[model samples]
Target: MQKTGLLFGSFNPIHIGHLALANYVLEYAPFDEVWFVVSPQNPLKNSEDLAPAQHRLAMTNLAINAEPRFKSSDIEFSMPVPSYTLNTLQRLNELHPTHDFSLIIGSDNLINIDRWHNFRTLLQEHSLLVYPRPEYPIEKAVIALPKSVNVLNAPMLDISSTLIRKGLKEKKNLRFLLPAGVYDYILQHRLYQQKKE
Candidate 1:
């Protein structure tokens, strides 16, 4: 079975941090491919400042265009708002029965995994590839993590889409923070620009 890592995110603009982490996971982990699962909306997060799903999906597609092992997924676009990971996993299994899917998430999310919808069953049925976040310490949560979850020593990228959007709104040049073509796409679409009052 081919192991696929599902990195779920809003991917408002899909930056270098996302690509770098995915690449690092592929190199150091056992995953055959990493899929960028672009979310339409996160139940746990506010939708304010979120780019349109089409734009987010397009940006994600642009960022991973050159990488064969990387894929962009819009599985949540047509699903109900506030999409749940469990549902997405079930859908993927039905669509691609041969591929083995695992959740790729930051340690911060792992610590709060219980808050997710049907989390216990999600953890029991699928594996997780957790990477470190600067603020979240996995050691404290080790006792709570399931046996199927594995932590990777991949580089901790502190970059975030929130800061990227802020920088763009502030007229800061953040091209280096994003993957090739993504910055251009954001610019061309005038995304994340401050709306004049």
Candidate 2:
């Protein structure tokens, strides 16, 4: 079975960091493809802070267009608001029974894995590919990780969608922060130029 890694995020605007991580995982991991699962809203995040789901999805698609192994999935857009990872994984399994699915997360998320809905069950049923995040040392964690988790020393970037948005709003020199097409899309749409009301 082909292995697919799911990277779930709001992707308010997709950036090079997101692409780099996914590309690095594809090169190093057993995954044949990596899907950018664009969530409409994370349960922990404020929905009002998000770009329109369609725009976010579009940006993700634009960011990954050149990579055949990278895909953009709006799986949570049609689902209920504040989608859970467990639910998305189950649904993907049901939809694509032939492929093996793994959840891609950062070390920070691994630290808070228990907070996820049905997290224990999710861990038991699916493999997790964890990458490094600054200040969240996976090696020093006190929590006993399950056998299903694989930690990778993938490259970490200090860039984030939040940072990109702030930079755009402030007219900072954020060139190369995003893919050329994605940055062009954001500028074309005039997104993140004004302060939020």
Candidate 3:
């Protein structure tokens, strides 16, 4: 049976950090493929700063073009906005019965997992691979997570999409922060650039 891992997030512009996490998970864990499930809108975030779903998806594709193990998905775009994790997992399970699915999340997200829609049910169904973020504590998160959670001390970079956007707005080069193709795409589209006062 094929084992697939789901790395769900609002990949505003898929950065090098995101790719690093995915690659690390694949290397450390037992998964055939890692899918980048791009969320349309995160209920907990402000949508104003988010780029259009299509644009984000296009950028994600460009970012992952060099990695055969990384696949970009727009499943949430087809579903309702502010898509819930439970629903997405259920749909994926049904559509690909032959593949065993696991959820890959950051330690920070695990701290707020209780707030997600039907989070308890989500935990029961899917195995989880939790990675550590810059400041988040793994031990503290491990105490709160269910038994299905697997904590990974994989290599991490202190880069974020928010930081990348800020760099773009300031007209700064995002040299190693994002994939070369993705950086070029952002410049070509003038994304994240501040409007003239």
Candidate 4:
């Protein structure tokens, strides 16, 4: 059976860190392709701060287009708000039963898994591939992880969408932090410069 790693996030604007991390996961982990699942509504976050789902999906596609193993997923666009991983995973299984899917997430997200809806059931069934995140220590997470969970040693950068958006609002340099095409698209569309009113 083909294996696919699902990396779920808003991808407000796909950046270099996101692409780099996805590449790292594909190279070091056991998976055929890494799908960047762009969430339309993340329950833990305020949707007002998110870019439009189509724009976010487009940016993600631009960032990963050159890499065959990387894909942009808009699966959550038609799904209900405050998207639940369990529901999405269930739907994905129904849609593609032939492929085995693993959840790829950041170490920080793993720490808060208990807060996710039906997290326990999701944990029991699916394998988790975790990467390090800034300010979120991994050692404690490892102590309590399940047998199927894998903590990757991929390079952890302090980059975040918040800081990137702040830079854009302030007209600061963000050349290296974003992919060229993704950055260009953001610039062309004038995204993340001001909150949507």
Task: In candidate 3, list every pair of residues with a backbone clash.
Answer: none
Q: Compared with the true structure, what per-residue lDDT tens digits does model 1 show for residues 35-119?
A: 9999999899889899999999998888899999999888898899889999999999999999989889998898888789999
**Can you write out model 4's per-residue Cα lDDT over 99-194, one digit (the tens) per residue?**
899999998988888788988788888899889988887765634777888889899887888888889888776867887687778888888786
Q: What is the C-alpha local distance difference test score of candidate 2?
A: 0.87
Per-residue C-alpha lDDT of model 3 across residues 31-117, encoded as one tens digit per residue: 889999999999878887788888899998988888898898888888887899889998898888998989999888887787789
Q: How does residue 85 of candidate 2 score in lDDT?
A: 91
lDDT of 2 at 155: 85
The alpha-carbon deviation from the true structure for residue 48 of candidate 2, after best TM-score superposition, in angstroms, is 3.5
| Clashing residue pairs in candidate 1 (N, C-alpha, C atoms within 3 angstroms) | none
Lowest-lDDT window of 10 residues in candidate 3? 137-146
User: Candidates' lDDT values, in order?
Assistant: 0.91, 0.87, 0.86, 0.85
- Runs in model 1 with CA error above 4 Å? none
* Each prediction's RMSD to truth: 1.2, 1.4, 1.4, 1.8
Which candidate achieves the best lDDT against the true structure? Answer: 1
